[model samples]
Target chain A: AQTVTQSQPEMSVQEAETVTLSCTYDTSESNYYLFWYKQPPSRQMILVIRQEAYKQQNATENRFSVNFQKAAKSFSLKISDSQLGDTAMYFCAFSRYDNYGQNFVFGPGTRLSVLP
Target chain B: GAGVSQSPRYKVAKRGQDVALRCDPISGHVSLFWYQQALGQGPEFLTYFQNEAQLDKSGLPSDRFFAERPEGSVSTLKIQRTQQEDSAVYLCASSRTRNSNQPQHFGDGTRLSIL
Candidate 1:
């Protein structure tokens, strides 16, 4: 019943530049979690950053940070000083807890390329 | 490795053949999850396990798909009479517990190609 959307199919940024990937979701649950995952050619989905819906404060990890707008149902990732290694398929995911564990619902994904 | 481990990084099977993918979650992890990701698409939840109990399997695509975690650590996803549509990367993830805030650690995934 919950869905995540990544509007950008592909994006490119010059090295050392800044890039922001947009994401939005539809969910009635007021309490939930938003996440950004990066999947490289190696086939592993690595956690970039996560934001709790209850926390208005954005989440930051090194060069990766999230602009979480709960009311707007938008969660965006901003990568500063982008490097070549940042090139990957970035996915926006949603998860909310249940009696056992939460289920992860991921967006289509955005392919990012960092050029020199 | 400290992270989740999946076997046979790549698998090629003929149509209608049976294939089994393995996943080894992190030691002491209480929750494990399985997902299927098609080409150019995001991963979709297939099943979930809490320790040895399969609490949720609502995401499984069809009756041909089966998953089991007997010891609460190692798991296997078996597909019987596999079809072309079953060709996708099977991903496994684990977390410290069945908590909302716990981040899931993912394995590299097992890419299954149907020929």
Candidate 2:
């Protein structure tokens, strides 16, 4: 079975600053995908960013990026220029690649607060 | 629909009552997913559907839980004789395809409160 771990239960960052949320996973599959999802007060789960295990280059989506260390089994999300809107519950997820009906294993989550 | 849509954004049910939650995936989407999110916890997969065919249901915790996508567009999750432990947010998501590479689009979840 695969499991994702988010060590930080809560995090805070000042507006305009950068923050990094740590995530690690345990999976025996050589090929997989990592993802970060955000859930705001509205309770809508939104995809933040995703990284393919086979890609050596990290995935970047504007201010959001991921530092994927395949060997270390770590995939961290970096949010640059944090804003108040960025405050939300962030989750790390893992999925196996090349599988039909792939299910995701998610971490507990990290509540982020962006202070002005 | 422009995005995934879930009905009965909030549901309150007494213990032992039967409840049904509905989800309408985006048009042309081939994959649909259901997840349960407990308070302060991340969403956990409950089931997956590929165009009306339930391909995976290993995540369902008990036999009381049932889901169906009769026409491949709209899906429903039914919980019979619900228990307090079944109280949680039920989320529905959809993707263009069943491929793992595609990102899923989610709907505002239906919050189920079992009393």
Best DockQ goes to which candidate? 2
TM-score of each: 0.98, 0.99
What's model 1's lDDT at A24?
A: 98
Model 1: residue A79 alpha-carbon error in angstroms: 0.2
Native-vs-model 2 lDDT? 0.95
TM-score of chain B of 1: 0.98
lDDT (tens digit, per residue) of candidate 1 on B2-93: 88999999999999999999999999999999999999999999999999999899999999999999999999999999899998999999
Over B13-105, each residue of candidate 2 has an lDDT whose tens digit, in order, gives 999999999999999999999999999999999999999899999999999999999999999999999999999999999999889878888
- What lDDT tens digits, residue by residue, belong to model 2 across residues A1-110? 99999999999999999999999999999999899999999999899999999999999999999999999999999999999999999999998996575878899999
Backbone clashes in model 1, listed as residue pairs: none
On residues A15-87, what C-alpha lDDT tens digit does candidate 1 reach at each position? 9999999999999999899899999988899999999999989999999999999999999999999999999
